[model samples]
Target: MSPTVHEIRNAIRAATGRFEREFEASFTKEELQAICEALKITVDGAGRPSTTRMRQQIRAQVGIAESLETADDSTFRKAELQAIADGIEASSDQ
Candidate 1:
């Protein structure tokens, strides 16, 4: 089975030094908000803070480069490929 989100979060946390505070990939909305407040990052004009925008801003402030993982789309099953395509199209429509 694929790893759970909590498992992924735990694995990332384990990779960091014992006392080091590297930003995590699986922060909840509340946890992310706390991080932003601690970092003194003000939100852009908005009703609610976007977790995605907050993550980008935090990564930028902390000098962490966001890396994109590339993979062969040909390796994915048709249903999986369709889901990915659907997600891309939906996001593009926004």
Candidate 2:
């Protein structure tokens, strides 16, 4: 199942810190793009955003510690990412 708007908000907040331990899942390409916007990180439309690009943007802007960062986009989870789009009413699809 997907997450609630509130949950996504919390997840977004958590992404700046200890993200991996916060959630377990992967955001879709669409959801990842939405997150970048929500976090005020502009994504160059060179192509569809990938996990690496988004993660780099998030890391660069948010400055999540590498020593503390985890391996995957499991930071906020796929559901939370979808909720970001839904909560903001930015996009219809995840």
Candidate 3:
């Protein structure tokens, strides 16, 4: 039987939550930008791109990065974590 719309939405939400936690923990700004480019996602705007924009673009391109194993932390860095946190905080302030 086909899944209900509610079931599909719930499944997507759960997957997105998992992706967000893993992506934030492992990806850097540069890495995200690269992924966006690879996915042909535009990360720029009339002015400089906002982190929120970049993040949305990256999230949309999560499938590209999803192949990587979450158990691998080799690409994770402290600076990237700080950047993600700062961007989130800055957006919240506005």
Candidate 4:
């Protein structure tokens, strides 16, 4: 079954909480605010988290600007390929 709007909203909230916790450890408030702006998310005037529009905006931005048209089959394979390529080129003249 497809997720309801409430479910999606809850998921976003949970993910945002995790992000904020992680960011708090490594970033300043200003940096985190900038990231929020980039994501187009913000709290509404009512004090409730209101990221519905921002989530759509961010998704659209990514969909429109993504350079990768194809999906990566696996993250590990992609990392392995990158490491191999970098190693070969780096060792060529070293």
Best by TM-score: 2
| lDDT of the structure predicted as candidate 3 | 0.40
If ranked by TM-score, best first, what sequence of candidates would result? 2, 1, 3, 4
Candidate 1 residue lDDT tens string, 1-65: 54433443333233321122344344556655555564567877666577777666555444343
Q: Estimate each model's TM-score.
A: 0.41, 0.43, 0.32, 0.27
Regarding TM-score, does 2 or 4 come out ahead? 2
Query: Tens digits of per-residue lDDT for model 3 on 29-60?
Result: 55455444544677666855655456555443
Instruction: Please provide the root mean square deviation of candidate 1 (C-alpha atoms, Å).
Output: 14.4
Task: Give the residue spans of candidate 1 off by over 4 A.
Answer: 1-25, 66-94
Residue 14 in model 3: lDDT? 37
Candidate 1 Cα lDDT to native: 0.43
TM-score quality measure for candidate 4: 0.27
* Tens digits of per-residue lDDT for model 4, 1-94: 5443333333333434423232213233343333345455453355433343332333333343242223232212223322322322212121
Cα lDDT of all candidates, in order?
0.43, 0.52, 0.40, 0.33
Q: After superposition, how far is residue 28 of candidate 1 from its true place, in Å?
A: 1.0
> Per-residue lDDT for 5 in model 3?
34
- Residue pairs in clash, model 4: none
Candidate number achieving the greatest lDDT relative to the actual structure: 2
Per-residue CA lDDT of model 2 for 1-94, tens digit only, reads 5555445544544453323334434555665676677678778777776777776665544445242244234454445455444444443222
By lDDT: ranked, best first: 2, 1, 3, 4
Q: Candidate 2 at 17: error in angstroms?
A: 21
